[model samples]
Structures are given as structure tokens and as C-alpha cells.
Target: MSVWDSIVGQQAVVGQLQAIVSGDPKALAQSWLICGPPGSGRSNVARAFAAALESPDRGLSDEPTNITRQVLSGTHPDVTTLATNKVTIGIDDVRQLILTSEQMPSTAPWRIIIIEDVDRMLERTTNVLLKEIEEPSPHTIWLLCAPSAQDVLPTIRSRTRIVNLAVPSTKAVADYLMASVNPALPAERQFDRHVAVRAARLAEGHIGIAKLYASDTQVMSDRDELIVGLLGLRKASDAVLLADDLIDTAKSQAEADVNRQTAAAEADFRRINGLGEQDRIPPKLRGAYNAIAKKDEIKRRATRRSRDVLDRALNSAASIYRDIAVLQNNAEDAVGLINMENRTAIAELSARLSRQEVVDRLEAITVARKRLLGNGNPMLVFEALFCALIPGRL
Candidate 1:
């Protein structure tokens, strides 16, 4: 009946975690890897362990004493969590996490650190982390989560114990949705159900994604339609329109992201210039011009990527519909690389296309994705993809 019990379909993982809980978790080696598919509760399970280790049940009390409250929150002696706030977790952040690992807890009995999306850590970050993992820290523990065990470095993986969370079934996802949504919601309304269903269908056992899909059906619908359209290889007018839509959207996202990065860079630049005015500017600050230059470069890359993302989004939209077309025609399973959302549509479209033709369409979409990421011209990529999708039609 502990908090760990709530995790669904992860019996083996739960057993392992429970054993770790029963033993001297603080004394245990400070490193462990929790591997699971997306939405499989990897982070949740890890957090639950951190909470229990920090809990009063373990006899340690790192109580939270705020101005207004006593946050008995996981009263464990020492626990710190690090994760990606940006799109990537670079080396600097990982270095900070490692530095903190060397410190003694301010209050908690045991020191625990959780790194979510450990796979997202850049190469430099991972390299810095390797040293910390290799060293000893009796009171400190590390929990890293990733899509798979292979996602991390061999040295890091070899040193740590591993726990794999189970992928819950659709029913389990649905049941979770039933319990997780707002209770005040009208009984007849199936908003949560719709989301859970879509996530279950698309994410294919990713609880995080299922919840996301369930939480925002409209967005999912829009995303699904977009993918469907792109893959289906619509008309020239449609392609132009899709390209325009993607370009506009990418422009906005790129600008925003660039602005944020630019602002951070400019702030540092100003601080450096001020220091120089007072003759306090260090070599590092003076060298920060390179940093500023790099920021601009990254902004430009992101700007370019925005266009690519828009194109990919459209391609994904087309693929979904193409899947429907093929599925309807009794097309071979080979074409349905991912979830087959519209079986009826696939069956219907299959009537018009040969099995090879449907498979070709799917392949075209895949090629489109690769081309975009590889800096393949989007206009040309989309054009080629459309031509292939439509066959003899121009």
C-alpha cells in the first residue's frame, strides 16, 4: 500500500524497487538506471523512490520549514534532482549536478539525486558525469532515467543497477485516466477518455504521452490531421498551402526561441562590457564574445530548424492519412510503421492504391523526415514526396 504500489503493470520493477526500499538505500551504491518506454512511469517510479528514501518512515527527517508551512515533504536527509529545462541538457548543467553530489546534505539523512531525461544530456555533460559516477559517495544516490538502457554510456550503465518499468496496457491507461481526471467533470463527458484512448493508441504504452493526448485532444487532433495530410500526398495547391503554414509557424517558434537565447547572451555581454569599463573584466568575459557569436549561430540554426519542423509536421500529418488509406485496402502490415489510427481510411484508400503504392507512400514520408533533418531542401523534398504519393498525377 506504499506509494510505489500505485504504479501500474510494473510488478517486476516494483519488486526490485521495493527490495531497494527494504534494504539500506542510503548505503547502496549511489547510481542506478531506470529504463522504460515513453509514458511508462520511469520518472514517476524514480521520484517515488526518492520520496520514500526522504520520507520519515525511513527514520530521517529533512522536513521543509517554510514561513507558512512545515513541508514534511520527503524528509530524507539529502536529495537533489537535475533535468533539462531547455530542449537539451548541456554539459554545464551536468557539471553543476556533479558538484552538488560532492556536498553534504543541509538537513536530509540521505542524499539522492535524480536526473530525468538522462539521454538528453549532451556529450560533454555525459563525460563530466562519468567521473562522478565512477567515484564513491556513500550517502549520495543517483537515479537516471532514459528511453532505454542503451541510451546511456556503457561505463555509466555498467556501474549502475537497472530497473525496467513495464508498458501498461490500453485498459490500464483508460483506468488511469478514469482516476486521474477532474472529478467535478460531468459524468457524460469523455474528454479524458478520448485523450487516454488517443495516447494509448498513438504513444503505444507511453503513459506520459497518453496523458498528454488525453489532456489536449484538440491539439492531438490537429497534429493527427496534419500528419495524415502530409503523408497522403495531397494536391499542389495543398502542398503550397501546407508549406506556407509550416513556414509561418516555424518562423514564430524560431523567433521566440532565438529571442530567449539572444536575451540571455546579451545580458551576459552587457555584464561583461560593464566589467571592462571598470577594468574588472576577466579573460573569460572578454572571451564571451565568442559565446555571443555562438548564440547567434545557434539562433540561426534554430531558425532554419523551425522551417524543417513545420515541414516534418506536415509530413507526419500526411503519413497518418496514408496509413488510413493503406489499412483500408488490406495493405500489408509493413506500411503501418507506427500506430494505424484510421483503419477505415486505410481500407478505403487501399482500394485506390496497390500494396506497394501504400508502402511507397510511407517510405516517402520517412525519406521526407530524413531529408529535412539532413538539411535536404524542404520545398524539393515535399515536391518529390507529393509526386511519389500521387503516382502519375502531377
Candidate 2:
């Protein structure tokens, strides 16, 4: 129940950070870079470390405590967490982080700044804080998280201590999901041990995705539908249509997300400014408020949508190829299918397609992902991706 307890399958990392929290000089560092695959709890560890630094007893508790909760919720005065919902973390964002780094802690022993997705920063933006990261104040600490050290620039990478977290085993992920979160699910939504293990296997060691598949029937259905659509692929026209369909779906989901975020931001702004439900902003301040909402908040969400949608679609496409590869190699029993329930369709597809073709298709998916990240038009990128999935297509 201590801050470290929530981190799963990272005993080495936990032990190291715990030593630092306990004032072990040998374990302390001014800056740290924590790298892990998606859902490997990079941010969780960073925030937990922050909590440990701020807590009066240095997270010595054997029970869950409010200090960890406050840190996670972004209410702790001593901790500043920088997370971008945008496509990239810009210079302005890094400057803001730098500004906070200069400030001393209000009450805690250190002023801890945790930046999630440090890999998202532009090369120029990352360069701006080289000095600060290398030479922060004695009471300041920076905890940066990304998918890998390679994703970060060498300059920034060299300045920090590195902690790499491996993907946990399927059994480990399933056990945590079933034992911790699944039991608290409402009766109608609860998943049994069988379902939990299946979800964990399907998610391929991604804890967050495993939880989604276990708890949400609709997400599982969507995944099933996507897999079925992938297996049904035949020729050029179908691939094009499928690409259009996936892109359109992503756009719709992004629009819904944007609307939800906008509404929440407006509501928060009204509450802060003492405005009522029906109140209108005064003309003098209206322009400023509108600018903040449009340029800063909503704009960021739009960029995030582009990347998120593409990543999701790419992962879905990649899963099919991965299953195909397993089936083609006759390794079904040795390395079970990710789409386990679709074994029949997978076997049929394996019979129809060469293993090399499947590997080529996966390579195409990787190329398209890079193009999309490079700001290639998503429609064009997806069109190319789907067409490539059909071996004989343009």
C-alpha cells in the first residue's frame, strides 16, 4: 500500500527509487530518464517518486496514503507534472517547465518536475533546457519519461540517469488486473479469471489495454470487428474502402474527444471566474479567454487526435499481421494468437497468404506510422498503408 506498491513487476526500479527516497546518497540523481514500453508504468513510477520526496515520512507507510493520491491528482504544491495532449511539446511548454525548475519547494524537501512523453519534444525545444537538466539547483529534481532512450536526443539522454522498465509477463499483468481492479467492477461488468487472462494475452503485455479489454465489452467488440475486417481483406478496392473507414472512425472519435475536453475547460474557467451557467464574458476579457481556449487548449487536443488515431489504427493492423506470422509458421501452440478467439479466420488467412507477405505487410504498417508522425496527410498515409496490406495492390 506504500507509493511503491502500485508499481507492478519493477522491483529493481522500485528498490532503487526507494533508496533515493530514503536519502541514500549513492542512489540520488539530479535528473532521471525512465523508459518503458506503453503501459509499463513510466509515469506511475515518476509520480510515485515525487510523492515519496514530498511526504513527511518519505513514503514509509505500509498503507495507501493521501500524499500519493494528491501527487497523482496534480494537487501537490511541490510537484509539477508536464504532460502534453498535443502532437509535440513545443518551446513554450519547455520554457514553462524551466521556469518551474528554478523555483524552490514550498514545503517539500525538493521541487520535483515530472515530464511525461519527453520524446514528444522538438529537437530545438529539448535543446533549450540542456543547461537546466545538467545543472539544476541542489533542491530541484527532474524525472523524464519516454518509450526509450533512443527516442530522446543524445544531449538530453546523456545528462540524466536512465531507468529502463521491461514489459511484465502476461501472467503478471493478468494477476494484477484480476486481483486488484476486476474485483471492484460492478456485477454486470466484472470479468472472471478466464476473461482477465485472455485480455492480458490479447493486449500483449500492455497493462492499460488489458484492463480495457477486461472491463469494457464495447472495446473488445471493436477490437474483434477490426480483426475480422483485417482478415476479410481481399483486393485493392476493399483496402481503399477500409482505409477510408478507419480514418473516418478516428476523426469521429477525435471530434467527440475534443468536444468533451472543450466543455470541461469552459466549465472550469467559468467556475474560476465566478461566472454563472448563463453568464457571458465581458467584452474586454472575452477576447483573451477565447484566445486561450482556441490556441492553447483546443489546438493541442486536435494534434493529439491525429497521432492517437493513427497509432491505434496502426496497432490494430499490426496485430493481424503478427497473428498471421504466428499461424503461418505453425507456431500457434508455442506462441498463441493475439486474436485468440479468431483462430479459425487466422488459420484460413494463413492458408491463403505467404509468411513473407505478412512480414512485408507489417513493414508497410511501420513505414506508414513514420510518415504520419512526420506530418504526412493521414488520409494519404492510411491509403498507402491499406493498399500495401493487399500484396498485389498499388
Q: Give the alpha carbon lDDT tens digit for every residue of 132-191 in model 1.
A: 777746667788999899988787899888888778877777677667653434556447
**Cα shift from native, residue 53, model 2 (Å):** 2.3
Question: Once model 1 is optimally superposed onto the true structure by TM-score, how far is the C-alpha of residue 234 displaced, in angstroms?
Answer: 3.9
Which parts of model 1 have CA positions greater than 4 angstroms off?
5-8, 58-77, 85-88, 184-195, 227-232, 243-341, 348-394
Candidate with top TM-score is 2
- Give the alpha carbon lDDT tens digit for every residue of 159-246 in model 2: 9999999887788888888888788888899988898888888778878878877997765676676677777778778777877777
Candidate 1 local lDDT, residue 332: 48
**Clashes (N, CA, C under 3 Å) per candidate:** 31, 0
The lDDT per prediction is 0.64, 0.82
Candidate 2: the clashing residue pairs are none
Q: How high is each candidate's TM-score?
A: 0.65, 0.83
| Candidate of highest lDDT | 2
